[model samples]
Target chain A: MRIERELMRGAGPVAVLKLLERHEMYGYELIDALSKRSEGVLALGQSTLYPMLYNMEAKGLIESTERAAPSGRERRYYRLTRTGHAQLAQQTEQWVAISRAMLALGILPGPTTTQEALA
Target chain B: MTTTAPQHESPPAPQRLWSDILTTPVGDLLRGRIGARCRPRPRDLIATCGLPAELASLVWEVVRRTRLWSTEKVAVSRELIAHFEDGLAVGTSAAELGVSFGDPAQAAALIRRAKRRNRPLIWKAAKLAENAVAAVLSLALLLYTIQVVRLYSHAPNITRNYVSEWNQDALTVPPAERAWPVYLAAMQATNGYWEHNWHGDELSPGSSSWPDITEFINSNGRALELYRQAAAMPKIGLVLGREPDVDYMVNNAGQPIKNAGAAPDPNPEFISVLLPPLTTFRSVSGMLKVDVYLAAQAGDAQRTQHNLDAVFGIVAHAREVRLMLADLVALTIAGDACRTIGALLRANPQLFDDHQLAQIAHRLAGLGGPEGLRTRFASERATVEDFLQRYFTDDGHGDGLGRPELLARLAVFTSGDPAPTRWTPTIGLNTVLMPAISPFMAGKREMLAKCLDFFGRYEAEAATPLWQRSPTTVDDEFIQFRTSLRNEVRYAPLMILMPSLGRAGLMYEYFAQQRDATTAALALALYHRQHGSWPQSLNELVPQLLPQVPPDRYDGQPLKYCLVDGHPLLYSIGVNRKDDGGRLPSPPPDGTKTPLAELNRQARRWQPAPTAQRGAGAAMEKPLPDGDWLLWPPVE
Candidate 1:
């Protein structure tokens, strides 16, 4: 759980950047894509999503273009700029090593077989 | 049964959270709870502060209620709750709600919305939201919309209460410093007017208008003192008719000519009469409004037909000054309320341009209009005092005493050159024609015959008239109209001080807009010059602010002002015009029409801060009353 918190807390900005790395996505699609990838483990608020995306865009971490939804509603399409992709790569490697150290710990004496890998 | 989909598990009882939030502003507290997990939109920034504050409260109520009725119960995240529950309720209230529904979160939120919405005020609020939701839901219904159901309403009661609270002393006559100097002075002048009339000479009221303003200072002197003592009253003004109080016919000796019976002389009727109090001499006003009709259904067929035909004739053969639609534009401009309506007319042309149209527009302009005048039935005005001092010594007639013609003798006391500049004793004996004179013009006549006419009218009644008409005219229609408006307005008389102020108040606006940011720099400098002390009003910096502040243009009245921090506020009680927005010399905090403190209160209603201050206004939506305006930033 502690490992999950650490990874999830900083993972939002990095994960948002990763989704935008290939192509731009609207808020609804961005949430859906991330949910599918994380298998519902990370559930970020749709409300909080825009301000962060907009703040990063202001900071030049990403670039955005306005697109019309199929219903003709205006939506902001967010894409990772060069700096955003670079930051995402750096954050991904750091989180991978830390996540490895946590899962490697084996239970000392459990009723279950120790030779079996933890589900 | 109404079908509602159970979207999520019921939430735990949020009673503890709700109670904690009771002390805080409900808007903020509710937003924290309900606004979570929803699309982020600007909430507090553009909140419509319209009528019925409960609408906002209801929205928050519904949101918080929904959250509590959900299945989350005790599992509700702290981030989702805007307000904090006390330690006691953290365990109990949540458990109670959780026990009700298998899903504590869903049930808690639903119960909260339903419970808070139990009142009639919330039912209206739900209707408000439902309408907006309907607009987005059904385009067909939205297409034919003439007006939308709105949560915020501009209530007559709120403004009425505001005006009444400020107008507590509207009719109070304050005590004078020297005990009604103008009344004393007018009495002395009457003696001179009497003696001259007997000598077949005339008297003209010179410089009486200046004394005319004394009633404002005198009549309300005691009330003002009380106000000053209590420190609770705002500035309310009194009108003095702007003309001399007593008109008289006099003899050659510049004294009024009285009969041997010591009554009014019948020859030319030489006598002094006090005209009705001055409040009636003020101008009238109108406002802007509209009504839509399915068709021109005439109210009265005869009158309607006459009105229609009159319009056609007027348009067909209109002459110079024949009253056209343009006249309304001119009247609106003259009234100084042209900005809003003028812009509307400029936008659409197909809606109007005929005589009947202008007439209807003029009628609408007076919809919910303000009264034409205030302070009616002023019979007890200090200016009409009844005290008289009489003395008889020697007549200097025949007993070997030298005597001259009345005019020649009165002239000895008042006249020197062919055109005299000082007070003269020589006057006429005629006083019978006074009733023919206009009371406002009694002081301006030069003929010996006219002086007789001026003094003839004294006991004229000024029982209040219609809002648009008063002071009794040949056509009593204005009287009836003015009365109807007064009845309909059903508010305080403070509204009458707006329009005349609307015109004269331009001086301060001019000063505010002066190129130097000059007022600002000067205010800042003065604030610093005073050793960081604040001055009470702009008058302290009059010669400092400008060469001299100008009198009002509508009626040559002087402007009043006050200062807060370093910026100056300028105002004038409009003469029976409803544009000053009820700004007065001294306004209470809760008074309507957005006086200075109220402006600040409106600006800082949510968050209290030192920088939260008042000006004429910080923006357009917050416009200050015409006379009751302030400079934006305090200088220095």
Candidate 2:
């Protein structure tokens, strides 16, 4: 639910970019990573993931290869091109600046009293 | 996630649109607490017993009480059968119900459902139709489906939901409908006539002169008779032929009239064509019944356009498939005829040396050459003929007629004077127009190639500064590029032939208009008279009013309807997706050209039919032979 709320707040596009920053991966692995890293909290669906992947790929922010694996399963893997890395760097800088401003105003909530809860 | 994408899906279930039905008042009655079998007071019965088929639907209407129940008649009958078998009747108590006819338990009723084999009739038929393991069985099944059951375009919206709901039922429609026997009888008569007529005229290939006319009257006449019989067959294999058959037959002789003493035999050899005399119609019928049960089970589980399309396409193709067979028969006959003539020459004394036949042999080898349809064998045919003529004269066996004169004379004997009757079918060897057959056994491959070539050429012509075929200035509202005599000629006589589908199309056009008050009113009258009250559905009046119920072309679903006190309303949501009953639809939906059934009384008095009127109802059903394809009445 929180992930869905975050998605509504435009975190989805940014989260996808961040995932691309980490490594090139297929929709399934990307879904798996989102679920694992968020401890299963990032409730992304294949439908949403595919359309976003397609949009990003079309926009040239990331590159992908639709090929069969040695395992014989066909998967489309995404790779973080230099353009994706550059976009990620720029996005990260803005996030850092916003966090600092929020902290200076004492508007930031205290860190949640819990473990990362990674899957 | 693994996508469970099976290659084939089950047939569509438009009748099980429970939600859509529930929207109708009749839905409440059928699904209400009164039970699947409901008792209605005698005051509700309006006995119009003349039309029994319509009356049957009316009985359901009074029982269901709603004018629109999505259930097929077969479904209702199955429910009735189950109710009666369980010793249950429609009424609650003696006071609440009266046996005006007879006790429901003891009532003589025909069960519309397939006889519960409760066993797999054929375990093989029960398998998914994706693989080729059942190719032969499936081909025959496809042929059978073509004969009786017709597939129509359906509303895709309720297909999935409808199938799911209907699948829950205990009984489903069998392979053939209840009236199938009568329909089949009609078709069988036509088919028998053709076979009997063929036997009557005893003619064989290469017999003699009058033998050809005898063959023509026997073989060709039988073929015509066979075509005529097609119309009487069931809706399953209704063939929609293209226009232009007479012109094709009148001029271009389909058979090889002038062979170089060698031509292929006419009949095609199907290795698995043999069947036992013990193979009774009932046996085939039983297998089909099982197939339908299996198909129904599939309908319950899944619904997809591809599934229904396959059924309909297979049905359509079954009748139309004869054209493909025609091509096959033509090829084999031509080839065999050529071969036979060539062999005859080789037996004779030295006639232009053996190379004449040898050269023709090279051309025949190209039957497997890159193309798929082999037509046009001119030069090889010519060379062989010239050699034979020279030999006959050199040996003093010439029929007093000289070589050129003889060749010309021979042409007259076969085709007639001046205009040659013996023109060659374009074999792949001589003409670039016809493609080689072996490599591409499928016929459409060459036609597709020709289409692609023409597309590019036409595009170039279109790009020209001015029209070349003729002049048509932008200011002048005029047409250009008339059809050339040769250009207009079609190769196959059967391919171009279409009967007078004229009035049927007119009726169809009128039906497409929702505002035909006469049609709507007539439909309502028929409904009221039959059900003792207004009927709830178009189906309630099928056999009585329309010969058959027409499916909506838009989504291939049954046309939508609602019921009133004494009338059932039929209408299609026009192309605009707005209900137009049967009037002019706006910017029509892409391919949704529905001949929307209106209330039978609403038809306009003088609206001219656009094409041929093919309106829904008992207007007229083309009669058929015993078990043949459905054909239209022959065109003038």
Candidate 3:
């Protein structure tokens, strides 16, 4: 199922920042990782994904550089800035609070709040 | 796990001038509705994948619509195309790949919206500036319409009738009619900046401007021609253009008009008042020097006599105009002219006949009196008083400041708006706004009156002999009054106050000295003619020649005079008002001081040892102090 636009917009930069924190990822690889990690829930289209990355880069949350991957094809790898790490930490706490509020309202289940479920 | 470190990094952006901010590419992009779409590039469509033609075209269209920088465009394009290729590698059909990316148009719109939000800081600033300028211009236009209605709606009959009465009085006299036009025309033609570079090196080895002096003679010819005409006129008055500025359009040419308050439309960004008169004075002075040189060369005695008469007439015109306008700088120009003519006569003493020399002495005696300067000072006060009475009430509330016309005109002037631009109407709107907020309107009439009073008091004080006048006391009061008005906008209406107002007294002082010195020099010339020898003292010429000796205005003492090797030397006590025992300083190497300093007491003032002065090409020594007011005769 496709994610709603407003929900995707709020979580987009935070998700990108979280992925870049572990290791630099090209655009296509990030799309795949986000799909697999979120169980296809946050699978952004190719068009949506590139523009999102651009917005994050412009905000200084992530920076991009082109390099030859191990597959001998050129790919743009994005890495998190110091600002991105701080932003991720802040957004994660807000999202946790939001999930707790939704759970108290019985809108979301308690199982989804766990780290493994989140991953 | 590719390392983040990458090689071949692009160079950092170069520094741009602040002026380049508006002209940059991003400045253009952000100033639109959704910003212009980026141009479609062929490279985006030329991907290696053997994808379906229609799918490739759709993807290309989407990327082209996004207004990203070239590098950003390439990254977006390649990644999207790579996603498609990955789908195909997973055996996904063309339709499935298209569905995965969503509708092409929707994707393009999302990217565009994102681009707008992520603009560079400079681009954002430029957009803000553009919007601000647009808002200001719109508000200015609205205010401008209100101002125009305010100015034209009210028929200020009191001011109009007052101006008409003054105009009628102006119609009765032809003030300096003959000389005024010629002087203006000559001024327009020959006048230029008196900067040092304009004249070049006066003592250059083979300078051509000296001998022919064609430019000098031609300009003088115009002034002299005008002078002769004015001298021949039956009568001449001191009145010129007057107040409200409309009289110039209504009155006949050559008629004198009463000067009134500031006009609604003054000559916008006009040349300074000091420039026209000072430049004209310099032109006339330069002519006097050149005429004397030419007369000396041709041995044209008649021409020299005409030149002397022309100098007197032109200088008289200058004095009258300057006094009428209360222009202090013109007084200095008058002094400069007198000195130049004096030097000319002293250098070519033989050029004048005995009778002509006596007449010169007589003329000098007549012009030396300070009656004209005093009269002009009083006249300026009366004019300002009239303006205050007619335009303002007893409590200082009247139309001159309260009117929209003056306010608008002043705004135009202060805004530095080009006089002919669309902003002219808007500039006037400032007057409407100013009265509401500006502290100047409270007692603006009194402030103007005070400004005029300062000029009047200082000018009258200037006439007092240097010994009796306390310059520091006068200056202290002036400084105190000015400091009280500091940063106050009300006094801005007194914009007619020239920079030369305070310093004009010095010019008057110099004029007095020049007059006294010229009189003494002429008297000496006459005595020499009668006795065939220099007088023993100025007293020798007292009863028969001079009536009485002229005293230096500096210290109210008899002007210092001496006969050095049979050449007459004369000077005042100068600004310092000290007698340096008739001493003169030596000439500077650059020849700024005329070589005339080498003659008279200057010879002994410096390098007292006469024997040490003798050498093989010793070169001109630096000049000594000439007791400040040195105008000794050249060896000639």
Candidate 4:
């Protein structure tokens, strides 16, 4: 099921910045990586993804440069700045605590409990 | 719970106005649109990503579907097409790849929102500044319009107010006898006879006018007696007539009394009434000249000194009434009398007492102040203000354009009919546009005040160096101010009426220099009379003969004094302000041909027909070189 827009709003930039933290990525590459890494739970549309990336770039959380890709086609590559790295670390910690709280309330399965529940 | 993406149902899309106003891309902004070559051109787009015909058509379709500004559309199309090409390489169908990126309509809305957030702070600030400037300009224009309207509404009262405040009734004729023709004829005859003989330097009975003025005085002793009584009268006390037209004046035969020359002109009709009082002063002065001449002929110094005192008394009265032009005439008459006194002393040396010499020095010092000329210019400003205010408010009634009562008092003379002098508001021009044009008068008024201020300063520091004096520098500043003021708006019409306003200032410089020379020369003569020899320097005349050495108004130094061949020689530094070691500069070429009074009359001729500049050297507001204006005690 697709997540509600409000639920994804707060998490989008941190997820994008975290992905860019791994390596520089273009628009389509970032979209594919986000969907695979989150197992489709955080999959975003191309229309939403590009605008969010532009907003981050405008805010200077990320920066973009145009260069030739492996396919010998020009593509805009976005990368995280130092500020983005710090933001991503803080967002990761907040999400982890949230997950732990959800586990205690039995809303989310804990890491060890998740494999047993599936069996 | 149904979780299979809600088993999608097809829905119609929303449409919005595709305004391209906000879509300036970052690249176009950076390169400043003029340098937009750095942005991806359409050819760059096609060459970078080789697409099939259908794919190329789809890319153009997507761009056309969006509401982006031209440059932003090109950038978006090129990037998205390349993304599609990448998808095609991954084995996705073209149509499926296009759908995979999402709806074009949704992308347009999101991009527009993103661009809004990305606007620069500086652009917003610049927009705010532009609005502020527009508001200020509008407010200034509004205030200027209000001021012009107020000036027009209140103009009629300024003259009445100034007249009442200054008590100008003392300078006019009485109303009960205003229409008497005999009085008008006598005034016309007075002006005609005065103009007839005014050019001559020597006012003896045989010279200037042998039979006309001298015979008229001998035959019409009653007229001369009337003038003598009027001169001794404490106040001017003539009531100004506020008649409607120039035809208000008539001769004893009930015919119109035209002006003094060939034709019976009525142009100076307003000043005609004012001239009678001046005529009284002239008569008194003419009689004084006669008394001095006859006294000197008999070698009678006491009678000459008595007549000279009476001339000085009339001069003081003229100055007191603020009749500048009249006062100047009185001073000239006094100068002639003083010359007669010097002649008497020289013809028979030791002819006068020391007390008589001291009294002569004291009277000359009284006439030396620059106040009379200053008051004259002040009255001119008031009159001009009255004239313009009257001209502007001429609302075309019985008393409006056709008949202005102000012309009954303030006379204007030119060769032609004075009908064109009436300035009316034209339909599309002056009526609507005069509000924008009238504020320039404020600048004109300010410059006039500066001219008056220069007179005050020249009087106060009449002994300062030429380099330190303010006339030339103030004149330079006035030219600059006037040029810039003229460029702001065309005020050619009002300028027609008062073209001499700019050069009226130079009159003060002339009068000041003349008065200073007379005072210094009188003091020098007094010194010679007391010491039995000429004083070596002006300092020897101080404390008793003169309170202080009189200053040369031109160079602002003590009047140059030297004894050449045992005679006292006194002179101003002239306009050049250099001491030629008491040597007078050669006079102007025209000086010998035309008498000083005739040249002055030519200068006073109503200046350039109101259609041209008043004088050729009108722009030269600096002092004119007219020799050292020597005071050599009329050679022994």
Q: Which candidate is the best by lDDT?
A: 3
User: How would you order the candidates by DockQ, starting with the best?
Assistant: 4, 3, 1, 2
Tens digits of per-residue lDDT, candidate 3, B128-231, equal 99999999988776666654454345433333332233235334656545444455444334333222323523421135645445554554465546544553
- Model 3 chain B scores worst on lDDT over the 10 consecutive residues at B3-12
DockQ of each: 0.01, 0.00, 0.33, 0.48
Tell me the whole-model lDDT of each prediction, alpha carbons only: 0.32, 0.33, 0.56, 0.54
lDDT of 1 by residue, B1-636 (tens): 122222332222334465445534455456564533342321231123221222223323334444432222211222112111211123423332222222323333434443334325775688789987887667644431311111011111111222222223332535332122332233333222222221100111122432332223244334323322221112112212212332332222244423222443222101122221111110001100110110112123233323223222221111111112222222322222222223222232223334433443333233222521111111211111110001001222211111112223224323434353445433232111111111211111111122222212111212211122223332233234335654223211111211111112122223222211222223434344454654564445456533444443223344444453443444333322223533432443466454353443222121111111233335543432333322233211
Q: How well does chain A score by TM in each candidate?
A: 0.73, 0.75, 0.88, 0.86
Give the per-prediction TM-score of chain B. 0.15, 0.18, 0.55, 0.53
- Which interface RMSD values do the candidates have, in the order shown? 16.0, 25.3, 2.2, 1.4
Q: Could you tell me the lDDT of residue B167 within candidate 3? A: 31
- Model 1 bad stretches (over 4 Å): A1-6, A103-119, B1-636
TM-scores of all candidate predictions against the true structure? 0.17, 0.17, 0.48, 0.49
Clashing pairs in 3: B242-B258, B242-B259, B243-B260, B408-B428, B585-B624, B586-B623, B586-B624
Name the better of 1 and 4 by TM-score.
4
The superposed Cα distance between candidate 4 and the true structure at residue A118, in angstroms, equals: 31
What tens digits encode model 4's per-residue C-alpha lDDT throughout B42-70? 43464345675445555555555555555
For each candidate, report what fraction of the true interface contacts it reproduces.
0.00, 0.00, 0.46, 0.56
Task: Indicate the docking level reached by candidate 4.
Answer: acceptable
